[model samples]
Target chain A: MKRLRVDRWTGQLLLARPGACPASTPRTALRPAAASRCAAVRTRSTRAMPEIPTDEDYADGTDHTRFPPLEKLPPRATSLPSPPPERALQSAKLAALHARLSLPEKLPLQTLARALVDNSADENPLFNNTNLAFVGQSLIHYHVAEWLMCRYPRLPMEILYAAMKGYAGPAALHHVARSWGLEHAAAPGGEVDPGLLQFSLHKPGNAIVTLGYKRAEAEGLQKYKWRHGISSRVVFDDDFGQVVETDKATQLRRADTEYGNEYTRSLAEKAYANCARAVVGAIYAHAGREPAKAFIRSHILSRTLDLSALFSFKKPTRELALLCAREDFEFPIARLLSETGRLSRTPVFVVGIFSGKDKLGEAAGPSLEVARNKAAMNALKSWYLYSPGEHVRVPSDMLAEDAQPWTPAYIDMGEIIGR
Target chain B: MEAVVTRPALSCCRRAASSAPSSTRLLLNSSLPSGTRQKSTAARTRRALNIPPHPSFLHPNKTPESVASRPTSDEIIFNPPSSAPSVFHTPFKFLPKTDPRRMANLTSNLFASSTTIQYNYSPSSAASPSAETTTTPSPESFPSIEGPPVLKPRHHLTPQDIEQMRRLREQDPVTNSVQNLARQFQCSKLFVLMCCQAPKEHQQKIKEQEEKVKARWGPRRRAAREERHRRMEMLFNGQL
Candidate 1:
């Protein structure tokens, strides 16, 4: 939102040494890269190396383009799996993207360029968006969670998780990134524009696990029908309320995983989603809290996802009855509102659920049972999807300048526990 | 409207003509000239959703101006392809609150074919999410084919009454069917069915009757029903 500053987002990445990036504690030690030799400095010594201790550049055989914009590159710059950090300053596509996003003028092109590089493209954390994406993921998760809880206070835990995934999950964020009109390079190379999202479909990205804890039986959680409740999911699983796939087991399987499969589509989605998170991370890292929240609000939160469409009731009438019993409401009784063509083919019946005089919901169906089920579902949706208001104040609103003193949002007791 | 569009359409086409990659080269991911945005054209040997290219893809990408050229006719009205959304019509719910689009949507009902022929898609409904575009758009949640329902929801059934009703229905399910029991107890047929599980013979009888009814259905009606069933399945799985 501010005018361009000379030393903004670039301060962090600009200071980063080319050869001596932090190789500390890799999740990639298990997954082998086909181009592992390009980033030889990493595969050789992740632990042995100190950060920026030496200025020695790892050299491979190929010549790389350097100065004057026409010269063939030398080995030092081109040999690395991804482009040199200095290249970010000169990239036209990177500059175009920054302008397109209307990103804070404080956010530098170099950090934005770094955000384009997936960890799979370049194992070096300095080159890739891992650190930035980690920060962005947390910020995004926090903002989305607070907004959902505040806006729709009575959402069932199951539905809440579903809503979270619909808003902030990799799939949703993938669409967000796509909407920004970003283009991805075929492969990661110094020759490619820094503006293009660079990733290797052949290799699984070592996306840094930031939000969730790794459970002991994480492998068994997905397999063997191991049932974990919503509370445990909050504590142990990822922010999307799914089992955290940060375990070594998933990573090991991911190594042999080829591109263009169903699994790899999720992998591509993760790559694009992390790219989005990296941009948000870059913003927060530069412009502080308020601008990042503003960006998320204008972009991600503004997308349309009908929350009512997410509900999948096994037995809606039963669930509505249970809900009424829990809330100390009057007993629910379905009444026939209307009917048509009763003696003819394709008869229609209209049913409504009532708790005393209050009409909970209504629907029309081909039969009495179907109509009643639909009405019950509608009533439950109106109950579960209750909103305080469209612009309800989330907890983060308190962090704004000249903000009102905290007025607590409505606290829902919880979803009905039913048999 | 067509005159307004031709100018912008020419400029957009010029951009496409000036420096566009050959169709084969675009797919091959041949080393593109630097700064020329060759989008995610690489490594897409396989895709989960093999979406067909838009009919308009053969031509240059249409600007908003080009969309204005869409013809209006009194006799034979034009509708956008179901797969593709019309550029002129954006559902009010999707637009950001600060968008300049709100003013335009409110002033004109884009769905209206011409000045003489206004579709039920009123400008009021297009401007707000609560517009009465469909039968069940708030106020009248439960709708009938003819008109809004005259009957209202009420609650008077007791637990003891429900218990007695259940016993009587269970005793002679054939004689005390759901519809008969509902009339006797002054409750909905759903309540009668909910309280007492229908006996196997009754359920079998209903299933056979449904099959007999289904047998009379034309191919088009049967296909529609099957499509609906599949849609519900997909909706429950949250794929929709």
Candidate 2:
């Protein structure tokens, strides 16, 4: 393979083919030799080089020469908010991370470096990873939602939203980024390493760039503790079914006074989450859908989450009764199946909830009432936790060309009784 | 053609009961004849499999005569008519005894009986049994109540009552219990507790008592309690 060197002043790639150095042209000639010699000199030079050319020097358009002074060129030539794209090649950390993730060869280091530059670090749209992160967020949310829907068809809306957050929310993704052994720059600037995650800690930027419609009452939502219906949230909120608060702009304006340790920590978390999303986005853009989906499944969806613990039942017994009524079954009745040491301080009572002759659920507790309540709760949980099978196919499975004719997935009639 | 068209609309209304409003039902009812409408409504309310018995006038043989005549709803009998045993009843019965899941199932099912019975005996009846018992305590031996205790009506406490309560609390804050004050004032214990102001010393004593009780908990119990609290926090934070 022929080595290529990017011209700093003109922003053009000059290929150095073997035995053809293009010596006849003045500007093109002596480029490869001088670039190689400068690299060797940088390693050997004990003292720092002289100050690089200012922006004016590039604008003056100096005359072409056979031997260009490589040391006089700026350390960073790009005027972008982030480090120059050429730095991606020299970053050892970036190379290690790319290999660690086993990323495809097609996914270039430049895109990976761009993924690390959060919007908070670089406000410029051309340089930052905002667009890539947006694409990644959509793909991640779509796969997660479909999998969760097919896997546990009976999860209530609240539990479903909670599960989605548990898998793909900022805090969860922050943990994902940390597990990848990613290091963040102390502060984001053009001088910082391109490999390190660059995001400002003091200034709270608009880190969340989602394709969601903001409700008019969003301003008053947190301040007034407004009631946002679950259905409304599905329409107006972000992918996780949460209200997308765009108050970060206002918060940033007050950053001088409002900036605290807690605020900075949360900002760091959001920045890390965005970086993870951007990486997924870069994979999709470069390598296409299959690899990106595989990456998400292996990393994010593979994590364990206890779906049963997401329930917070206010009245389990009443809900069970209503469920029986709705299903037109026999009214649920709690009965004491057995007891031991009833008079003792640590008495145990076993209770069972029966619908007709079927023992719906059973549980043991310290008291008869507690046991009965727990039995009722368990019965409701079992009914809600029904699954057709582990390998139930989702809608996305039909996207494959050779997939068999799609069969409709089993969907329950939602929660038996809403709170 | 008319019958075929109406059949789809009728079935549509029936299916719409779950998702649509009752206005569609009203529209369907207006089109139906009164006589058939009542019959259809009754059929819609009936469950899929279990057909409830009609009145005796409508069906004489369907009436339940005794305890055995009616099926008990005490426990659910799977495959009510089938005598075959359920596969789920002993799903892991084939597994080795040392398997954790099998052991859990075994221990859980140890007290899985389907019935409960309670017996009661009178003292006088017990005393007369076998003719060797001592004199039994008669019903009149205990003082009889005239009637049920009357609950004090709300909003009956005067300004003077509040003043007296305050004075009593101020005089002996440590000795006064919220319950005793409530009984004296003929009000709820919560109201009395809210009204009474505890001194700093009393508050400190209460805090010390709570701490003492908490200190008595074993390491395992403490860890379990903390774990429960952490799980609750995770649930609230939507991280679980």
TM-score of chain A of each: 0.80, 0.81
Categorize the docking of model 1. incorrect
Query: What is the DockQ for all candidates, taken in turn?
Result: 0.04, 0.01
Model 1 global lDDT (CA atoms, 0 to 1): 0.67
CA displacement after TM-score superposition, residue B21 of candidate 2 (Å):
87
Error of 1 at A351 (Å): 0.9
State the lDDT at B99 in candidate 2.
35
Off by over 4 Å in 2: A1-80, A249-260, B1-240
Interface RMSD of each: 11.4, 13.9
After superposition, which runs of candidate 1 have C-alpha atoms over 4 Å from their true positions?
A1-75, A246-259, B1-240
In terms of lDDT, the poorest run of 10 residues in model 2 chain A is A14-23
Report the error of model 2 at residue A383, Å: 1.6
TM-score of chain B of each: 0.33, 0.33
For candidate 1, the share of real interface contacts preserved is 0.04
Which candidate number maximizes lDDT? Answer: 1
Residue range with the least summed lDDT across 10 consecutive positions in model 2 chain B: B111-120
